[model samples]
Target: MPDAPLTQVLAPDVSPRPSACPGLWRIVTARDGGICRIKLPGGVLLADQADAVADAAERFAGGVIEATNRGNLQVRGIGADHHGLLDALLAAGLGPREAAGDDVRNLMLSPLAGLDPLMLLDVRPLAAQLLRMLETTPRLHELSAKFAVQLDGGEGLAMLEHPHDLWLSAVRLEQRTWLAFGLAGCPAQQRALGAVPVEQGLALVRAVLERFLDLARPEQSRMRHLLDTCPADAFVAGLGLAIRRDAAVLAWRRPASRAKWLGVLPQRQGLALGVAPPLGRLTPAMLRGAARLAREAGDGSLRLSPWQSLLLPGFDSARAHEGLAELAALGLLCSAGQPLARLVACTGSRGCAKAQADTKADAVVLAGLLHQGGPGSVHLSGCPRSCAVAHVAPATLLARAPGRYDLYLRDARLPGFGVLRATDLTPEEAGALLDLPTEHLDD
Candidate 1:
């Protein structure tokens, strides 16, 4: 249950322009038909909204709704009725306040942002503010749909490896709370370029975005792309703002978050439940059931995690097991150590033309062959686009052809799915090698 009904909300009279990315209004044409990506706020979607999405998918487009790796929803196989589909979603209060603001709303927070017991800060307020800035500011519309930001509240359940164009983390120096800001990399790996007082968050974001737009060419879509040409230090030095780089702020680093994503997560006040649809594909029933559970047992809202799961926060911890039981009934993977939890697969030949193998169908066979969870996470991509995951997974099984793959292990010395461990292995061979429970693959 969100604070208010996102009811028939039309983001004032604005028409979104055409782009490669999909939006409520600008449905991008795909091999299937059209694609519409619904960006959930903090990845929170209400039960009513879920129902609305389901209805829209069934009536106005093809019934194939996809749960994106970034925790948003995308509907594929759209027919000629794209406008009708957009209207249905907008009527459900799923569209942005400004049509231009749709793609710019890429901000990721931990699913348990406000509720996580081990969090240093509750990021709800700042997240809301930053979202507003990106939405209402007309200049930000010039940014690419792929230009994204991350806000780490220091929650134990945070996703830290995903690279962001602009990142901010909660940090304490001396006796005061400040936000450490960086550009072109994730908060976990890159050192903070500067810090700003918590109160200046809006101004800080404005400055960084303005600087990015000011310097970047249209061809450079992402911050990292621009940074490739312009040195990070030169880019930072050009920002005409007072940035604090003292030992107190610069000496800090974003600490590691607990990797447990699916299960009952403890909250400061009560409890929150995290669950994922297997391989992130949800039947309409599964979506509706989770939404109903969120409304009845927890807060009236559901937060979607970057791990391709959904969370219901503010539930009574005493009733957690009861809620967990209900979630399990919805065909969601709740337990962390489950074999399917560690395996990720893209929409292979079943959905995309470039795919040689049906990765989703093959993932099922591979999961059964593996028989158990291992020390690392594995991504099975049809091609190398790696749509199911944004960050480099601990292990990658890149499909070469039908039932054949190239296995890559997580190696610090390499990039893009890490070191190539083996090639041209059958699914059984991959399972034999990946089933080993050795040292932790990633910290």
Candidate 2:
């Protein structure tokens, strides 16, 4: 367990390393009000817990709850009752295992980590162990909240592009599961930097994080930033652990996940239904309805996705389609062909002070225009911080001023939102351009 509350341990004057990113304690003020983020373990939320969150948002906030990109939830427009809201959430078992563990609880796993039929291994056990180590290690608390780790268990349905500070993907060699790891990159785009047998996976993660904290400057909060100065080979050598860096292991590339976040998905055994709250904001009613469905038709749990969505797992395949219809009827996007499902927007001027345009409102407009264009992912940023997306989307519309934006397409050769393809385009113009073939824009 961690020491005292992490918020108290830091010098209050330091103000969370000068970042506006929201954590459980550091509720960053926005145009709407104070935003309190609650990090859910393994993206699993029990039925009662979901109802509790909805109640907190309605009672202590402006009744606006957002499912975060990192598979968490945030209560927006929070009033003066921070403690009240915190108490309500804790009463629902949403707080960190220990107070000091809150800020560093950034770990990514597939929504179906344990239940996926097509996965090579069940990641829940290792995930629990790794999370415990991250919380117990006091030194790791110094790392930025943005610093994250990903544990991929070869699940057929997983988000593979979101780069993590340290990423480990499960691979089988000689009929035994081994964890292939890389630094400052994603399993889908980068080759494995090294591999460790499954038993050594937890230790490898610990070593890598500890070593990173030992050498990185305070400015280098991300692994990519640290790698710019530190040599990767030297960093690996210093781990002092037996790592298999053979040609075969180093050359391994993770296959892209063909799984879709919305619609019906076949598990190795049963069926699972995926859903997205429109624009990542969940109405209290929508949440309550989903929670009811989870408790009745499916497992007693809900899985939040990296796509800023949620899923009802362990569902009866015969009733899965019916459940999807129910969720869609509640204004949630449940089909891949839904236009809003392809659009992500940050809290803009309506809710965030840094925003120039109401990205959420504009996203709706863009979605209407792209209604018949099939599913195409687009991100609308209130400002350059890009709070709504953890990974690069196919297209990004950076807000320039009210009702206007400059569009960028994701290009491997370009950094930051990718290549700037159009400037000073409104949502209407961007929508028109996006309606063209997917090849027209870089992804």
- Poorest stretch of ten by lDDT in candidate 2: 7-16
lDDT of each: 0.81, 0.85
Backbone clash pairs in model 1 (N, Cα, C under 3 Å; residues 3+ apart or in different chains), count: 3
* Tens-digit per-residue lDDT, 1-443, candidate 2: 75553334442213334566776666777778888888887898999999999999999899999988878888899988676777677768886635566788888999989878779989999999988887788877788888899999999889899889999999988798999999998888999878999999989998999899998997788899889999888899999899999988987888889887788877777888999999999999999999999999898889998888999998988888789889988999887677888888999999877898999999999998985546468899989988888778888999999999999888878879999989999899988988887773433
The model with the greatest TM-score is 2
What would you estimate as the lDDT of candidate 2? 0.85
Write candidate 1's Cα lDDT for 230-286 as tens digits. 888788777777788888777788988765877777788887888888887777777
- TM-scores of all predicted structures: 0.93, 0.94
Which residue pairs collide in model 1, if any? 1-300, 1-301, 11-97
* Candidate 1, residue 192: how far the Cα is off, in Å: 0.9
